[model samples]
Target: MKNPETFPHPIGLMLFNRFEYSQQVLMSLSAQTLPVDQSKLYISIDGYSGSKAELQGKPDSTHAIEELARATFPNATIRRAEKNIGIAEVYFALEVSMLESHPDANWIGFFEEDYVPSPDYLEITSQLASAAQPIDDIAVVAATGETLDPDNRDVQGIFPIGHLWAYLVRVAHVRERRDDLEVFRQQMSGRPYWDRDKIALALVMASRGVFPIGVANDYQRLSLMFRFNRIGVTTGLSYGEYIGVEGEHMTEKSFARFKFSAPTTVPFDIATVDFSASISTLRDQYRADFAKSLAEQYVIPKIRAFTAQKSFKSLPRRRRVASLLGQAFRALF
Candidate 1:
């Protein structure tokens, strides 16, 4: 069970106006340990928007970015939006350009402009993705797993979708639930790219009257890996590095606050790793932990809050039973 000889999926790279950032990633992807040149390469660029331009502090250089992508991946199927579809919608755009365009393909590769995959990224992440495929709950597998490697724990596992830097997703897995995916995409489409990234994990919990205990509530669009039961599966050791500090989500002044790693020049290798190992056995434990936490931290606090509302005492005992729970889970936003 050694790794596959060649990367076997179409690759979609999502970009907007970050020519500098996009250039760094494109060159890195072209230099993967696996010859990804054989895979169908598609670049989806969001159309120009004034507000996005204002946020980036530069006029949209979409045309220049498109040319740079063309120069990097010569045979890429480039799809540039005619109008400024926001960041959330651009993901849907990439899905259509890659997966929908190539119906026979079972899995597709994905990358954002800021993710710099290690040379061995294709080999390792694809192996991680294959391991995740049989398990129905794991939605996507990523290369950037463990940022700071821990001793004896540097193997792939079902972890939270930390950041969707470089990853692979199954076509059939998404296509099977096309309607649901679309509904989700539409739900977050109107938000800024920044909010979409963080709101995902919280969305499902919020709907069910759950919230994190002193944790920031932000799932992801790439983090869309969260739809309640689904979790991101990735190698425990980080396979890639996230370099987008000042893009949609961060500023130079605030970059240090997030504790981001400086982009690395060091090479990562997958020497003598076991390919036959699977993480299926650990899912139950993770779920059990989640249930335990939900019961203690998330659910109980809500119950306490609901009981605090004056409505609890204002209503007769019979009326309080059903409506009380409904108010807690209500989608006020």
Candidate 2:
């Protein structure tokens, strides 16, 4: 609030090789009502040395991304890793860089190249952050609101899930949890970014009472979120589109299996909403959605596996129907 040259909330973007998406991000960011200042924009890109062959002779993509970023903002601070240090490491390192660079900032917004943010992304997240100031447990604020139709901006409510599509994380929480992340990093020290068994990671996290999903980096945050009984809030209407039909973690086949109740656009003219009032509404919604998702994602497969057991099939029809549930319940609990 004291300096006009400094951005209200310093922000950064984490990316690998998605130049086009990064460009879109920069353009949208540049167009922010909250202008994207060179002093405020930081870019952290992962190395592509190992993927030079995969990238088809583009071993210098990090340089290209830097050039592109500077051309847009002209003074953007860019951190390019020399080797492929992995997204998880790059992300945390970027956070530390932002913290050290903008010591006065209370929070930092982080984005990925896979999603294209709404023009109002900065303003909305700022409002969300301001509204969330008193709520310590709400560690992050996102623009991932859900609507039956993404194009229709009726503002159903804040999304109940922790979506990193575009998010703002509180500095205090990050400082408090940095040690936890270091421990997680140590646990995953030698593993390549793409080589993680996400299912196993989710299962391990579930045992610790955290939501059982996301990549290694995302999982690390989720663990901290649960550790302090914190939650992330989102806009009432989605603030971006997911154009990552095929990226590091998704393929055309895998992407097709996924669906969104909302389509591919964010409302451009949203007035500032005081989301602090609706925080509990979002929390309640998350509880219900998590319960439903847990059942559908975990329980049904378990029931199917139970019914398929030879011993289960051998039981009389009446007893087998009831007995199948016994095993599923045991597995679930």
Candidate 3:
């Protein structure tokens, strides 16, 4: 039998928290020149905690969201969670729900509350997903906010740079791996680490050799990695040992309190940037400074001593070998 025609609106965006950021994403989607009716919008709100006076009718979050629906896009379906699930759980739950709801959809697009899709975001996604027939192990196609070198841009199609804040993923590829996500969550449960759930998903997808599509100059999405590092490691643990008992040490100087701005801006054109393509020069400067401090104060001296000790290296290498193997398997299929 011949394959079914892919829908132009194969993309479904998952939105949660960040009311202000969500509003920006919604407005950007609304502003797209393509037919909005072709695509579907799903918003998953965890809970609203802000000035009660700011809300209309002083109602709860669901009610406030309902009011938002009436005032804004009433047609957009809004899903509300009763309790507060962390970012990772919320994203996973909503993604599973999206796949269940749209079983026939070729691709489900992921967008954080903070992302503002460019004019051709959906158009380009649909076009690429449709044009790339005989989809093999491919799972994701995304906007790499980091501009590729002029040489590599056209090579092997475009490679997704980084920052998975916004991307389109194959539905079947995701649904088939839903069970594994719970396993991943369980593995990472007690570790108390947090970051973009999509990054975890990307790692899992890439493990299976599923390539993330990168369309040059399509859109820009900000990376929220540093915020997660601060919250997870800096405040959570004072001095901890990672990678089993014989692994690296986490010390006081390894972490520090840092302040970040909400609703940070991302530049459209990045003519000048380090290889990392950091949007803000100041942000890059601060991160570089922090890295230097960490190496000097906490990591370098200790790591040097640890490596120099011959007895430490002679300790059981079996566990380390097994652990490295497991990580490699998890990251590469």
Report backbone clashes per prediction.
Answer: 7, 0, 2
TM for every model, in the order presented, reads 0.69, 0.82, 0.50
Superposed model 3: Cα runs more than 4 Å off: 1-7, 10-12, 48-66, 146-157, 187-333
Q: Once model 3 is optimally superposed onto the true structure by TM-score, how far is the C-alpha of residue 145 displaced, in angstroms?
A: 2.5
**TM-score for candidate 3:** 0.50
Whole-model Cα lDDT of every candidate shown, in order: 0.62, 0.68, 0.43
List candidate 1 segments past 4 Å from native: 1-6, 55-57, 146-160, 188-228, 261-281, 285-333
| Error at 175, model 1, angstroms | 2.4
Task: Write down the lDDT that model 2 would get.
Answer: 0.68
RMSD of 3: 14.3
lDDT of 3 at 173: 56
What are the per-residue Cα lDDT tens digits for candidate 2 across 27-94?
Answer: 77777666666787788888776543244664355677777877877787887777777777887788
What TM-score does candidate 1 get on C-alpha atoms?
A: 0.69
Candidate 1, residue 94: the lDDT equals: 71
lDDT for each residue of candidate 3 in 227-280, tens digit (9 for 90 to 100): 221100010101101111110122234422211112213322213212223224
